[model samples]
Target: MENYNVDTVLKDIFDSKDSNNWKPSDKIPLVTKEIETLKNDLKTFLKSSDYNMDAILKESQELCDETNLLVSGMEMCKQEIEEETMAEILHSIENHDRLTKELESVNFALNIVYDVVQCGKYVKEFDDGREAQSFTRAVEAVYDLLQYIEMPAEGFKQLDMYNNTRHTAQLILDSLLSDLYGEWDRLISTSVKPGNKKTTITITLNIEDSLIVIDVLNALEKSKKLVEKVMEFSQFLLKDVLVPIINNDCIVFAETDELMTITVNQKPDFKPAYDAVIANLRLLFHYLSNKLNVEYYRDNSIMKMMGKQICAEFSDILVKDCLIDTIPNNINELQSYGQITSEIEDFQHFLVIVKFFPDDKISILKYVNNIDILFASKSSQYFLETARTIMLKDLSVTMSIGVETIPEGNPGTSADVSGTEEEALKILNKTMPRSLFYFPRCMISKTAQELLDLVYVMMEQAVQCSDVVCKKLYNTTRLVFELYDAVVPYHHENYLQTIPQYVALFHNNCMYLAHNLQTFGDKWLILMEGRELDYPISFVDLVQKLRDLGYRHLAIHMQQQRKQILDNIRSSDLNCIVVKDVLSDNAEAAVRQCLRQLHLLKNVWIGVFPINVFTRLMATLVNMFVDELIHRVCTVEDISMEMATQLTDMYTLVVQKAPLLFQNTTDVEQYVKSWKKLQELIFVLGGSLKDIEKHWKDGTGPLAVHFNTEELRSLIKALFQNTQFRANLLSKIK
Candidate 1:
């Protein structure tokens, strides 16, 4: 049966044709063959097997019956057991639920008891630590109590014992903080306050005591108050001690072995005062560190607290109030302050040693470092005052006038003239005008020198300041010179008018100031060029103004001199010489008087102005006299032989004496513009008509060059006969 192929044979019969094409003949053989094969396989299976079919069926029916009977019996037994135990099971479940509730209640009560007992134990430890003065231990116990009370057993917070325990811990913590702060305040007061002690401040606490306080405050996270308390103490010291010492009140500073009371005296010295301040601070730090044991607590130590407060006091109180007033006003006084800056630097180093100040936090030191600028601001007034004194010393301040040497290869002075005798004379004459002149150098009055010295000192100080402050100081320096320009002209106007020497000195001073200031601003700018400047630095405008001022003074004085010279000529009555038979002594006396005035001016202006300017001025005055003399002579309508001779002699006297005005440096004609014209007029006045014609040379000679045709015609009509020859000569003069 297991090896039978019945399905394969049947499928072969069916699949031999399509279903629609099925026929008995096509399928009968395949079906019959499969049927025969099935029959054979069945017979073989039956013959080879050894089994009893009836017996096997009987055994299966017996097992099925037994299974049904067992199931019925089990169901009946389960129903009986359920009916008997149902009420007892429900009762036991109720009992178990009630007992569990009772057990939970008991455990909750035990937890409450444990939490309250633990809180009470910690409170007792906190109280014990407090009684023993062990603040760290007390704060630690309170810390534990606070931790436990944060989340106690459920419903434990509503209990009276729980809240009472937490409240007790809180009270202890507050008390500890208050006591610790009190101890800190005491430490500060004792360390900083001098009280009535004349010398060393006594420290009542040991190092262990100070450390105990520091540890307690830090444990409670309240060290920030330390800095606040220190600043308050610093203010107290500033008001009571520092203020008196700086203000030069009855309280003064004196050195002692330790913290000492300020000595009572009227005298105040900044050095000793500052030294006393530093000494007190040193003793304070020394006592606090050595005796109080605060050095061990580096973060919140007393030294650090006081160091920060002292740094602020240095800028706000010491620098602003006390040290600022100590700044010197003058250069001599400034010597006293040389070590003050160093002392401040030493104070900075001391701060560094104490490790209280950080390198990045130097704002207070910056204020102290600006001491130079402070000095400049204060001393600028001194600079101005000194300059004022020098300028106002006297109207007639003098210095021995010395000739400054001319550099080689520079333009020649009158002394350098060299040519033919006449050519050299002409060259010397050309050098006389002040308009085209050279000065080797001009001398300054003693007042001017003193002012310049002050200026140099001020500019040097200005260069040492910051750019903004330096500019201010330099502007102050400009004001100094401006003061001179203003003060001299105003205060000494009378002296300038009456005294030639004073006028000369004022002019030279003005020139000297102008000369130095020309490059003054630029020179300092170069020295101070490390910073960028916003505007140009130059005194070009000021130099021009000073020059104008000098010229104005000199011109005003020259006006008076001109009037005197012209008035002397008028007094001579030179018109009488043209018509009088005898020459008047008044003419000679007038020349002498004019020479006296010229000599006086020459004496004052000789060393003051350059040689050329002095000579030019003198020649200009002489030329004015010549102009007046000629005008007087021309006014005469006719002249006798004696009159012409007298006029000629007067001309000779002037020509011979006028050269003295130049100090013999040049000839008179060289500087005097109309000198030759005067000579030609004199020649024509004294000569005959033939001689005059020869001198005139038909309008091209000296006479024609000196006088116009009309002037020559007038002269000929007055001194010679109005004949056909004279008329012809005057016509020919053109």
Candidate 2:
């Protein structure tokens, strides 16, 4: 019965148009042949298989006709049933509508009765619970009854019974509130007993029963009253216990008998009393929060009020009494006070944790935090005074030889023992050598070292202080150094001039002070590491000031030495010296005196200053000497060969002796800038005009490098005749 259209099937199969090669028209003949073959096969199969095709079709038609007849008959039956039941259905709907209205009315009246009965039950339960002193349960019943009658159903609102019920519930709530208050009043009491030296608190409270009272008060919506009552109790405790403990000097709670022996060596310390006060305050907090369960009284906020009161009272005690006594007298005492302040801060943190004190509102350690202000003022005065005392007491310089022990592994390093192991027998045994040896230290004075030690102490205190107080302490640091800065030079003005040892020691002291002060700000910078400062303190400027102070004093001495040598040279009249008299010329004596003075300074400076600094100072002296000689010779109008010979001899003597000042170091020429130029000028003055031109090297030589054109011109005019060669050299020097 499932027939296929062979022509269409064959057309679809053979009509495959391959986009690569074949088109629909090209496969038409094959499609026609296949359709014919399929049709023939279908006909042959039908003819060979059966002959009942028409009869089957007729049977299917008959079944369709029978289904149609059944469907039509059922429709007729449905219409007949609907006609028969329509009137009864309408009547049932009418009865349902009428009963639903009556049901709604009855349910409404029943809900009202039920609600009223529930109210009455709760009221009765409240009355019974109140009688039984079950305040939690009684309060719960009153709360429920009040809620029920206060907000009745919308339909019941207009009824007189509901209005009366609301009134009765209000009265019941008032009575419940009154009973809760009465119970609370009976649960706790406080009595303060003031004594001669202390005050005692007598607190009576039912810890277990107070919890019940708190719960009843909370349930009755009277928690504010509970908070108020708790605050009142805390105030009494603060007044009677906290204040008295902090005020009394005795640490122990029990009164001590006068007959109790005191330790004579023991000093009176407030720490024990402070510890006891803190411990008692902690116990008070525990008693309120953990024992009485006051945290639950107002959602953990009941203690905040108490905390505020404690904050006020404790803060007052610290500021007005305790901190006033804690004024530190010295650094060690200040350190102790710092520790106490730290403990006070920790106590404040504890209050924040347990008593619900606000961190920002904590003022108990306010004065403690800023107490460094007072301490800084006192410290500044103390440092200034102590520095003045130290500076004034020992104005004399006590020179300490700077030494370091040779490392043990080094060869030939040994110790010198003057006294024998049997020194008890007064034996004097001496060793050949000593491992400990002296070296240069830009040596600081004893007073300077003491001042530095004081600065170190102040620095530590500043580092330990709070930022606000640290700033003030920095001023103290500045004041201490400023005092030294002003006082050191003024104190030793006379010695600095006459005493070479004093000058050297003073120079070393200034160098040491400046060197130590170089990192002075760095130590204080530890405070600003994690914090930003608007105006950061630095010792850079102060360090420069100290250096300048040292240089200023050194310059004063150098200028004095300079004036002495220059005066000696001026008085010798080298410009008018005899050409042939070379044995004992005034210039030679001046030169000798200059060298002698330099040698004396060298002796004082050796082993006192580091080699480089020694070389620098000696070279400076040599330069001054050579420069004055050059100035004298350059002023001479005509230098005969004999005068040049005398000047050359003086120059050679200076050169030979000046180098001995830097004996082991590099050379005098390396440190002294004008040394080579002075030699070149002396050569040019003594040599013929050719020697001058050759040394000049057509303006590209050492002569041209050291002496300016005007200097060489002046020298040429003073020493040489006005020849064209000199004029041309002068013109080329430009």
Candidate 3:
């Protein structure tokens, strides 16, 4: 009935504002009356015939289309704002690209300038002592290049050229410095005078500077593989060139004294070049020592060379003296001691002569004096003795040095037996010296008596030799006596069988010497006196005496003889008799006598011998007699306690008191017996004591029934009756 258009109504309301301002109360009454009238009219219109609804729906659809159009316009405005932002980003990217290219160009130009400055400094160092004009030109060229590098550039392409140019300039400067150094070395080495060479060269190189010194040292260290090359150059210069030039007589300069005087007149000039060369060599050695971990000294090798050079110089001086007739020919005619022979005998003979002659009377007194001086100053008696021996022997044969002979009927005889036709005999007399006679008398004098006693002991202990020659030199009876005395007392029977040959030879030598010297009259007497021989007899007579005495068959039937003597003693009715009377006058002689008797007894008694006798035989021989019997007992599977104890004690005694004397098999067996005896005694005694403790109170008459008198008697009888016990007891006899 009253379809209102809001925009038309709002426009009507705004347009009527000026009119409504005319009267608000009048407008309100008129509007209210018109609304009531419009309401009545709408109700009347609705109640009337149907109005057109299709036309109204068409107008509503047109209003919805207008709202959709307005929303589309707002979306289009947002898209236009985003497109403007994208345009601004594109413009910023182009600006960044332009700034990047400019920065790269600036960096490149700066790098070029830096490199050019470094290269120019190096070039200036290289050309430091060159012509000013040339140096100035080179410096200006470098400056111009630097300027060019500093010129403004647009991009990296232009700047890259500046960097390349700068690097090329550095390369050129390095090459120029290297060439200049080479030329400078060559010029200094060649152009300087010999006397001024060191100073000029040192100033030119300035190798003393820290940087320069380090470089040189580093180069030397790196050149280790070139050692052989350096050595070869040194050898060529010193040996091939310098040595020969210095040695040349034709190239002699002013006399040394004159040159030294003139040089002294002038102020001393410092040798910088010489010092540089020395420093260079020192650096080289230092590098080698560090690399190799060795001790290096410059003076050591140089001094060795200098020594050889000095020797050569001295030889040259002598040669020059000879050429100039500065020394007389007679000066060379002084007595020449001949070359020394290395033979020991030659040396020994020389010592004998030196010992016999008076020191002051020596013909070549200077050589003798040198020896005395050496002995006094150096305390090299051994070496001096050796040298003196050599010299004396050489002079003796070569110079025909005479040896004085003992006067006829003189009591004293010369020890030197040189030039005598009589063959020297090794007399087995206790009085003769055991050591080499030429041993310095002064040194031996302090111990002479002891040495003499040892010699006596050796002589007395010498077993006779089987040789005829030896028997003639040494008395056979004396040798046999010595063999008997040296043999273990009770075991003499065992050793007697083995020693006849040595005895026989000793006798043969003694006899031969006696027979040969008989015709020499007092000279033979003197020789005998020197040998200290007790009695002189022929070798044949001595052999005959030995044969008559049964010594010829002693070795063959010694065991049989010893057994016979044992049987005789065991069966003898005489009880408690002195063993000495039963055997011989002397103790040692009695032993030999008893041994022979026992060997005979063994053969006679054979199987009739008691077990105790056999055991005693073994023990006796085992204790004092070591031969097959002792060996058999030692190796036997079951050794009795008694035998073991005896062996232990014997061993202990021998080891402590006289070890050297017990070196023989028989003696060693005795010593072992002593040791075994001591050990067994300790064990048995300890066991017995332990048993006694178990059975007895602290103090008691008898510990137990087993320790009673009757029981002890029985045990004692059993022990004494034991084969080992009997043997051990019997062993102590002969």
- Best by the TM-score measure: 1
Query: In terms of lDDT, which candidate is stronger, 1 or 2?
Result: 1
**For model 3, how does the per-residue alpha-carbon lDDT over 477-562 read when each residue is reduced to its tens digit?**
23332332233122334333444322222222222223322332333333344343445533343334433333334334445544
CA lDDT scores, all candidates in order = 0.69, 0.68, 0.35
State the TM-score for model 1. 0.49
TM-score of 3: 0.20
* lDDT (Cα, tens digit) per residue for candidate 1, span 266-360: 44343445656555555444444443335434455555655566656554665666557567765466667768767766766765666545455
Count of clashing pairs, candidate 1? 1
TM-score of each: 0.49, 0.42, 0.20
lDDT of 2 by residue, 331-373 (tens): 5777666677777778778767775577687667666555666
